[model samples]
Target: MDQEDPGFSAVGEVAGDRVTVRVSGEVDMATADAMFRAATPGRVRAATLDLRAVTFFDSAAIHTLVRLADHYPGALKVFPSDRVRRVLDISGLGHQPWVSADQG
Candidate 1:
């Protein structure tokens, strides 16, 4: 599924048991839910969130990511942009096993 807002977009690609959702633009209260929904479609063994293009991320975005991490457990991986990384670091979530600067 693909979701688009004025300054945000989330597009998902599925391969076998894994779903990779690429998110761009600003992620705030207005777009976080949509991003979460787009990231998780039905049931998948694993999920990858690519937020390297996200220019802005807020608390709502963080909450959405946390929810997704919980939903996918150890199967969730997040590739964060520098902007998102700063927020995640400040929020103490950047050190999470799910979060990685490397694309892998």
Candidate 2:
């Protein structure tokens, strides 16, 4: 029997250098790469990651975000859920470009 596990469905919208990515499914080591690949390239002024629809997240996902922030200084923004924020906070990248979901 062949059983395949379907993964996350991330929707990304890009306008100019600003990109908004909405992740609805679990963000684990398996799926984090796709999200990073989907992000807008070349130093965007703003990047909004809407995780309001996300139900689960992991260290790899947080690592992805840290990489993005390091990838684009003063150009990466993350609109993370409270749960997500905790991860960012622990990673010490929360205060930089991170914004609360309701604020945006």
Local distance difference test scores for all models:
0.90, 0.71
TM-score per candidate: 0.92, 0.76
User: Over 4 Å off in model 1, which ranges?
Assistant: 1-4
RMSD of 2: 3.7
lDDT of 2 by residue, 1-104 (tens): 32211657667788987888887777877778877877755556667778766666789888888787776677766777777777667777677645564546
Residue-by-residue lDDT tens digits, candidate 1, 1-104 = 43546878899998998999999999988899988888888767899999999999999999999999899989999999999999999999989999996855
How much is 72 displaced in model 2, in angstroms?
2.0
Backbone clashes in each candidate structure, one number apiece? Answer: 0, 0
